[model samples]
Target: MYRFIMSLMLVLPVSVFSALNYLQEDITNDTTWTIQDSPVYIYGNITVKNGATLTIMSGVEVYFMLVEGDGGFREGSELYIADGKLIAEGTQLLPVIFTSGGDIRSDGDWGCIAVEDDSVVNLNHCVIEYAKAGLIFWNLSSMSEMASSVNYCRIYHSSEVGILFYNSSPTINFNSIKNNRYGIQTQGLSSPTVNYNDICSNYSYNFRNLSGLNQDATSNWWGTTNINEIEANIYDYYDNHNYGVVDYTPFLESSYFNEGGIGDKSLGWLRSIFVP
Candidate 1:
C-alpha cells in the first residue's frame, strides 16, 4: 500500500514539473536558470538580494501572473533586485522575453522588473512588454568593470513608463522604446547615457524630466526629422522651467538597428542617417 501511494505521487510530480516552473521567494544564492526551463512563471514577489547573482541564459521567457484590474503588482508577483546582479545574456538570434501570463493584450498586465541599489544588470536582446513599467533602475552606482548596460532590447506597451531612471547611470544604447504611455521618465538626478535608440510614438510624452538636471540625450532617432515634432512628444524645460532641457541634436535620421530582429545593424557606422 505504501509503495502504491508513493508511485502515484511520483508520477504526478514529474508531470507537473514538465509543464511549468513556478518561481517565488528570495534568491539568496548564486544560480543559473537556463533555457531548458524556458518559461518561468512568477507566482509571488521574488527578490534577488544579498549580493547574489541570478544568470538567465538566452531564449528564456519569464511570465508574470497578475490581477485583472488592480495592476498595482501588489498581488504577490513581481521581480526585484537589490545589491545583486541579473545577467540575462541573450543574443541576436534568440532574445529573452518578459510578458504577462493572463492571455490579454492590454497594458498593465503585470508590474515591472525593478533593479535598485547597487544591482548590476547586463540585459541585452530582450523584449519587455505589457507591464505597468517595463524596467525601473533606482540608486545604482554601477561603474568600471561592473558597469551596467541595457542594449539591443525592445521595451514597449507599458501602462505607465517604459523605463524609469532614478539617480542611476547605465549605458542605454540601441533600444526600441515605443508605444507606451511614457517612453522614459527621469528623476532623482539620474544621468543615463542615452544614445542610439528609437524613442518615439508613445501615447503620452515620450520623455519627461522631473530630475531638474540638464541632460545630454543625443544621437537617437525620434521617428521624425522635424524638430518641432520631436519636441512636442517630450516634456522637458520647454514645458516647465523647473525641469532640465534634453539636448537631442545630431540625432539619427533613420532607425539604427534593423527591423528584422535585435542587433541586426549594419557593419559600417551610421551618422545622421539610416543606421540599419
Candidate 2:
C-alpha cells in the first residue's frame, strides 16, 4: 500500500512587510517617493544633486535616524537640495510626516531639510518635528522666482530654530510654528514674508531678526491679543535697536492656538500614540 502526505503553505502579502529604507545617497535625476513606501527611513544625509528633482507623495512618512554627530555642523540625516528642486505637496487629509526614527524620540533627533543656494523648495501641508531645525534656506539665489515656499505646515519641537533663513527670502504663510527654541530666525538679508502664522509658546523667542533688516511680521496670532504679551515674545530691533525693526503690528483678533497641528487638524492623537 502506498500512502500520500499533504503539506500546508503559508504566504504573506507584500504590504505586510516594512517600508523601504535608504542610506546616504545622491539623487542625480528626477525621483518620486510614493505612499506605498510608507515610513521610509533616511539613515544618513540624502542629497539631491544639482539639476535634480525629488518629489514626495502624500501620506508618506519619512523618518530620520539619529546618527552620531553634531547636526548643526551638517553631520546627520538630512535632506539637502543643492541647486536642485524639492516638491513635497501633500493634501490636507493625507499630509506628509517627517519625524525621528528611534524608539525614544525627542528634539534634535536629526538635521533639517536644507535648501542650498540656487535650489528650489516647496513644502505644503507637511508635519516636521523633533529635528534641529524643521526647514532651512541657506544662501538662496537672487532669482525672483526661486524663493523657497513653505505653507500650511506644522513645524514644532525643534531643538534649535524652527525655520531658519540665511540670505533667502521665502514666502512663509499660514504655518503653525511653535514649541521650539526659536520660531523663525533670519540672518544676512533674509527677509521672508512672515504673515498669517500662529507663532507662540516658543522657549526662547518667536521671531528673531539677526539680519538687521526691517521685517514685516504682521497679522499673526501670538497666543494672545495683549500687546505686552506679544511684544515680549518677539526679539527684534526693539530689543536692541541696532537690529532691523520687526513690524509686528495689527495682530490678529482671534487666537490660532488650535491651528498648531498636522494636516488640517491637530495631531494630538499621533503624539499620544508615539510619545509613549
Best by lDDT: 2
Give the per-residue lDDT of model 2 (tens digit) for 1-276.
Answer: 001100111243433323334445678999888898676777678889869999998999888877876444355689888868998888889998999876777988888889878788899999999988889888845543246788888999999989998888889988899899999998887888988888889999999888778787876777876666767877876677667766676556665445432221123123223321
TM-score list, all predictions: 0.82, 0.83
| C-alpha lDDT values of all predictions | 0.76, 0.77
Clashes of each: 0, 0
Candidate 1, 1-276: lDDT as tens digits = 223433554667544633556665689899898899878877556789888998988999888776444333333256888778888888888898888866555787788888876688889999999988888887744332127889999999998999988887778899999999999898877778888899998998888888777666677888877777877888877687787777677677778774422222232123223311
Lowest summed lDDT over 10 consecutive residues: which window, candidate 1? 260-269
Q: How close is candidate 1 to the true structure, as a TM-score?
A: 0.82
